[model samples]
Target chain A: MDMIKIIKPGLLTTIQDNGRIGFQRYGIPVAGAMDDFAFRVANILVGNDEHEAVLEATFMGPIIEIGFDGFIAITGANMSPKLNEKNIHMWRSIEVHKGDQLSLSGAIEGLRTYIAFGGGIGVPEIMKSKSTYVRGSLGGYNGRKLMEGDEIPIDASKSKAKVGRYISPGYIPRYNNNNVVRVVLGPQDDHFSPEAIETFLNSEYKITAEADRMGYRLEGPKLTHVKGPDIISDGIVSGSVQVPGHGSPIVMMADRQTTGGYTKIATVISPDLPIMAQMGPGDTVRFKKVSVEESQNILFEYEEIISNIKYRVENSFIIQETDKLYNITIKKL
Target chain B: MYEKARFLPAGDKSLIIEFGDSISPEINKKIRDMYLAIEKSGLDGIIEMVPTYRSILVSYNPLNIIYEDLCHKLRELEDNLNDSGSEPAKVVEIPTIYGGDYGPDIEFVAQHNDLSVNEVIEIHSSRDYLIYMLGFTPGFPYLGGMSEKIETPRLKTPRTKIPAGSVGIAGKQTGIYPIDSPGGWQLIGRTPVKLFDPFAEPPVLLNPGDYVRFVPIDEKEYKYILKQVEENKFTVNIALLDK
Candidate 1:
């Protein structure tokens, strides 16, 4: 059955999941949702497994109509999602049957938003992944972004979740253009001069126009290297701060290649990846040096939040629909 | 960490143990041994391990195994690293059709090195190149020990899409393109064997520390192997190299 028919593909929209793991050794990138926190929340709200696929929209979102009786929850960036020409709430689960239309305008806050169907996307898996890596043309919906009139398959909802199952406002992360992201130095920090490392930590970098799932190129103070900026090709994980010969930095992201030849000065922590992913071009971000322990401490806390969210919904989901549903008078557009 | 081995932090989830800075059979052998030991240890929380030419990047879950504890266990594994369980290195014979459209740049490589096309093929197929690591593209091997006679510079402008199974040489290096991708490597031949099948169980045909010997074949044999690969009936000829 056709789950989602794209009437209009807004910005860049692609299917994503937890990630394709265990194959990085074969030079396969672990392509997945950039904002994993939001991605997981969207899946959890619809009572789907944490790894199920969801629609990850960047900047703008797709105007899609559903052909299944299931649920949908929008998370991450607030794109002012609408159902049948009426405003729908973000970070909340809502009901819809076949022929119901869903659409999202431009993002007002975060850079990426996730629209998760009830049972998740039912696309054919490549290397056991639903996530799209466009550069390698592997996985997800035909290994590319959604196009107009494309009919996407969706797994039927096995979720007993009520219409009001939502995440509270306290749990919803806020995204800003000016943000501070944490970084842990290493792997190749010794390749840089001490003063260059200090420069990297102190300088404020703005996200350049070349930002995407592969990596976010940041323009800032040039980081000088003790030797030339080349390293023998090695495995690259997401959040690696690789400095090419030009001296600018690029934070390798989820869809990054398995290996790179440039020298990586530092790596951003996992907990801050979502925050970094939500940042768009021209956004100014300052880097703060944190130890692995301090960074891991935050990571533990972040994981704690996700584990507790599923049980705390329904009777008291965000904007708790139990008490009252917001009345909106639909206007003829 | 050992004296020559430098353990560097790659964020909270990964650790890079650099054994050396250059590519050699000895360093790669040590890496392969260490990789097998760590992989076979059944250590908890270890997600994946990528063995490069000189380093092995170990990705693990911090929630289950912190970097410190993981490093401690890795140290133990490193001390206990042995070659007892490792099978003898196998050489994968890659059947290739050289010259013509299959190797459009063979003439260029020949002229650059002052040799003929047959001499180029003779020099290229004479040795078993060590597979350093797979990177750049999926199943794309980083090979070592290419004959200096066949060495040539990469194209000034890279082709937008080089077909998969393209055998190429770049300067002091030579490798095959496992997938269709834009690259500057000078193409010299095309292999009929599929090095990467995303739908397969292992997906990749080559592994780190394996040796690849190119066996020159005619167009008929190339077409036969290509058909077998498409039909999923092609069993790669893997044999233990002579000790």
Candidate 2:
């Protein structure tokens, strides 16, 4: 029964998990952490399930005071972090003593940051998720952002683990400001003018100020659709780059609506979604079109490597340690 | 006889079954029929199925069902949709306000159509709008039934944000913005009622295949209805019709 009290809630911080599923039918969007890769990595660093509850901070993070000793890890954007006025490195697990105050400044680079607890941040799950959908006022921290004087409870089971284990830089996700997202042709890509499609692939688009978790409205060359081809409304997915009447493309992201009527010229591949999530306004993005098969192969290879690494780490935990220094001679006897 | 349907790839995880290029009751019925038949067939790995005016978008887990197989299953189900169209539909009435801040574009609509605001409201309120399909947002009904006399183009340089409950007319169609979202539809009026309430058992006020009627109310009545909704004292009336 330990808790963390928020002394200063920076910019926009909210408790999130993988997001609320099974409620899309209700018109409720699946609102969760903007960067799932970083969110999951922070959880994995502390031996917690990748989808366990965690804190999703915007460009700026919170100043928190731990009420009890615990292990924590920070991931995603490189926000300078200090614990009790001592500088701490990002992407590594650290032990916190009770009464220690942790402060995170504005992100020096990147747009989002994930904070994960060893046992997971304790929050009631609504519709099977702790992610907050602020529009509907559903899920997470009373369906709102974390504020000053807010005290969030931590799962007591997490306190039993031995603290002070540090994560190395290798575990950290590197954020690239100039991102080139890989994409595949959408269903309605044929509806767009051939020249427009070619221009889309060849040009570099700048992320405009009109951006949010729902989608990023890009400002670039006008992408015109074929004269007689108007797309009807249909289901939309994250990473779908839709072109509205204005001729600008909006790349739908995590909090995007489930459906739309705009013609989608391209969809970002699943593997490159993490890189896109880290991008902020004014960032330039180039879209590289790849075949569906190639995109799937990339995703498959990434998953295989992740699983293999997890297998090695989980196996290490089960192996017994030997006291080799005490006995120089063979112990076959 | 209807035209042959085409299957297009929606994304890495979905497929769009296009009935045709145009909107007609025939195509709309086919889309709904196909959706119902596929849903009842219990196609494995089909996570969610959405129907629009002319196409049905089926979303499935790529890990569970391959793209080719999902379409094959859909084709198998499409053959059985001829008999499902006889099912009944649920019709709903939605009360709304048609002038003032709720509907700043009311006068504009009147001016564009060469009719008075009262006549415009009368024409809009009298017709039964068909729910083509829900899209753009959750529980947001894309209705089809506005007379050409009252139809108006969307606002130029669209508002950055339109509050939820703002009723709008865009081109030939009209829909209520169930959530406070950025949009370009010309606002005709607003409603105090919640078009979508997540806390309710069925969150969306109107479902696909349901008919909707807009009843104009005065400002005093709008405030009264708003309070009634907050206090859970409002009851929505409906007229069931055979498909």
Q: Which ten residues in a row have the lowest lDDT in candidate 2 chain A?
A: A323-332
Candidate 1 stretches greater than 4 Å from native: A314-333, B1-4
Per-candidate interface DockQ score: 0.82, 0.38
Second chain TM-score for model 2: 0.89
lDDT of 1: 0.89
Give the DockQ of candidate 2.
0.38
Instruction: Please state what fraction of the native interface contacts candidate 2 reproduces.
Output: 0.33
Two-chain complex of model 1, DockQ on C-alpha atoms against the true structure? 0.82
Instruction: Go through the candidates in order and give each one's C-alpha lDDT.
Output: 0.89, 0.78
TM-score of each: 0.96, 0.83
Give the local distance difference test score of model 2: 0.78
